[model samples]
Target: MEFDLDYLVQQLPALRAGLLLTMQVSAIAILLSVVVGLLGASARVLRLPLLSPLIAAYVEFIRNTPLLVQLFFIFFGLPSFGLTLSLFWSGVLALTLWAGAFQVENVRGGLAAVSPGLGEAARALGLTRWQYLRLVGLPLAVRSGLPAMLNTGVSLVKNSAYVSAIGLQDLAGVAFDRIASDFRAFEMLAVLLVGYLALVLSLSAAVRLLEHRLQAPFRR
Candidate 1:
């Protein structure tokens, strides 16, 4: 079959829109994951009486399950319980929860890496627990975990393709739809491969730049 470059070019507008939606979902989900990670990690590290076990369970459950199953549960299964979310929000929520699980471990590991003597010294200097965490612990933990967190960010961007399963018009969905209509499977797939590669590569570069900036202080 002759490759249809013209047909692929004609679909650029739709592809662009799909890419925008993909980025939007990934950005929001990553932000939410950071929030969840920080809070979950803190609770676990501090061993908060009631919250620690719950966070641990959440992390384990999400880590153990497939992301697609989680998306399906949010987008499809919730309606049966009289809770319905729009497809976009459902995808975002599912990704957030799924990525947040891994983020929890990344953060927990970072926190654990902090020298125990540092905490003891902070206490000796008459710092309150909250003060020590805020002024000392949080920065160190984030610095240590930045690479893992950025990796999760990249994974989220790539996995955003899964949102297509719920009929969200992300890049994969758009590519699939275009192929179905034009019957140009190779052309469409090639375009998708390029699109995702470009996106992930761009994200990786940005993360590397940010990682360098964050590490500058520690390197001194």
Candidate 2:
């Protein structure tokens, strides 16, 4: 079979639109997941009574279940409970919660690595728990956990493809649609691989830059 350069060129507009949609969805989800990770990790580490145990249960549930099931439950099942969300928001919410669970553990591990002496010193210096976490502990924890956090971020971008299962016209969805109509499986699949690779590499590069900056103060 011949590679169809002209066919791909003709489909560029649709493909680009799909890629942009994926990027938009992934961006929103990544940002929200990071917020969830940090807050959840902080609460658990501080042992915030009811809230901490609830976060632990949430993390376990999300990590154990398949993402596709979660996606379906959000997109198809939630309407039964009168909590309907648009397709885009549903995808965003599912991805955010899924990735956020792993991130919570990743961040919690980093927080655990914080020296016990530091917490003691913080108290002796009259720094309240929240203040110490804000001013010192969280910064150090984030630096230690940056790699795992970014790994979850990269996975989040790739997993954005799952939104296509619900008929969201993201990159994978567009490829499947074009293949169904045009019968260009080779071309469409090839394009899908390239699009996802581009997204992952872009995210990895950004993560590396962030890691370097975060490590700078301790590089001496």
Q: Pick the candidate with the highest TM-score.
A: 2
lDDT of each candidate versus the true structure: 0.91, 0.94
Q: Residue-wise lDDT of candidate 1 within 1-220, one digit each (tens)?
A: 7888888788889999999999899999999999999889888888889999999999989999999999999998999999999989999999999999999999989988999999999999999877877788878999899989989989998899999998999989999987788788998889889988998899899888988998787785
lDDT of 2 at 25: 99
User: Positional deviation of 140 in candidate 1, in angstroms?
Assistant: 0.7
Per-candidate TM-scores read 0.96, 0.97
Model 2: per-residue lDDT, tens digit, 71-130? 999999999999999989999999999999998998888888899899999999999999
Q: How many backbone clashes does candidate 1 have?
A: 0
The per-residue C-alpha lDDT of model 2 at residue 91 equals 96
